[model samples]
Target: MISRIVRWAAQLVILAGIAAFIGALSVAPAFTYRPADMAFIRINFTHGAPRAECWRPTQAELTKLPPSQRRPNDCPRERPAIVLRFELDGVVLLDESLPPSGLSRDSPSPIYRGFSVAPGPHRLHLAMRDNPRTKEYDYTSDFDVMLSPQQNLVIGFDPRSGGFRIR
Candidate 1:
């Protein structure tokens, strides 16, 4: 009978100790997102454009390739590198060049970038160049954005619309 009482007492003590440990975690140290004034900016897109215009294949050139593999127009396998620039309130935040993807270098180039800034109204300028031979930008946009605390801003490219979309 004494042993049985002792075992029950030990179990109750252990349960109480566990409950106390859990209760301590609720108040002693606090954790938060840590900051309330920082906002985020993200750029992500995958784009594809020819470095130069395609041309009709000459009769002699077409004859060189196998009959099944010959194409009506001859296009280069290598695409131009993608150049992107981002500016905020006249301060340049990012400028980068990305090479073409795929083994044959004919695929779209993918880009993903991020930045942190204070939450407020700011001017944003964005430009991109997909043609290596051209000195002009293929796409450009300038606008103002009002960011909120902890807001996530995303800029994506849509060739169908011919520019970047902010979300």
Candidate 2:
């Protein structure tokens, strides 16, 4: 009787350990930082021009696109574009511009502002498409940003002030 009781207790311990291990493994991915999630910073363009408008893709709209079209590099060519370039620790992680319609653009927007950056102190730079007759305006700003785990950074362009803010 004593031996049987001991065996049962050992089995229960082993089963509990296995269950705990599986639980940890399942949650580990959520806790760990994914490279893709941190690859590009978000630059939100909310202020639209007099006739220009800005909108984000809904889940249904995103699903409507084919997998090939959903890629970051597969943006369609269009006008009135917005591109976001992200730098982390002074290193550029991603740099590509897209139109307000999420299409590709040959030149970046005129009012270039804001960038998403990794969690740390970083130097942010903005470049705008300019005509040869116009003066070039590239702005650089330094910020100490700290992003918590699973945090999505948002840099906004406020038309009223013609400036950017991190939210």
Candidate 3:
């Protein structure tokens, strides 16, 4: 009876020590994504660039091609690179071009970028040129946003809906 009582007491003490250690860990601040006063900006999108105009085959070219493989107006499957520019407040954040993906270089380009910044009123500028013909940005948007601490801002694009969307 005495040995059993002593074992129970020891087990209770060990359990209490573990509980206190866990409680202390729970009260300590350790893990954090970003600084307490910082905010986040992310731009992610996939877009297909416009292909160049198709060309019709000449008589000589048609004769050279196999009968089953001959095409009158052969269109190009390769697309151009995608141009993107981003400006935050009055400063430029990003300005670069991204090439198309896939083995044939005919697939949509995927882009993802992130930035950490101070929280408050900010001016967001976004622009993209998906067409080879256009000299300037084919799509553009500007917004004034108020960001709180640890807030996340995401920018997206969809050509069918006319481009840039913010969330």
TM-score between model 1 and native:
0.74
Q: State which candidate has the highest TM-score.
A: 3
Model 2 per-residue lDDT tens digits across residues 57-113: 666777899976554333334444434455556577556544443234333344334
**Per-residue lDDT tens digits of candidate 3, residues 89-139?**
979999989899999999988899999999999999989998878899999
> Which scores higher on lDDT, 1 or 2?
1
lDDT of each candidate versus the true structure? 0.88, 0.52, 0.91
Runs in model 2 with CA error above 4 Å?
Answer: 1-40, 46-84, 100-119, 128-135, 138-140
Root-mean-square deviation of candidate 1: 3.8
Q: Model 3 misses residue 96 by how many Å? A: 1.3
Steric overlap count per candidate: 0, 2, 0
Q: Sum up the clashes in candidate 2.
A: 2
List clashing residue pairs in candidate 1: none
Candidate 3 achieves a global lDDT of: 0.91
TM-score of each: 0.74, 0.39, 0.76
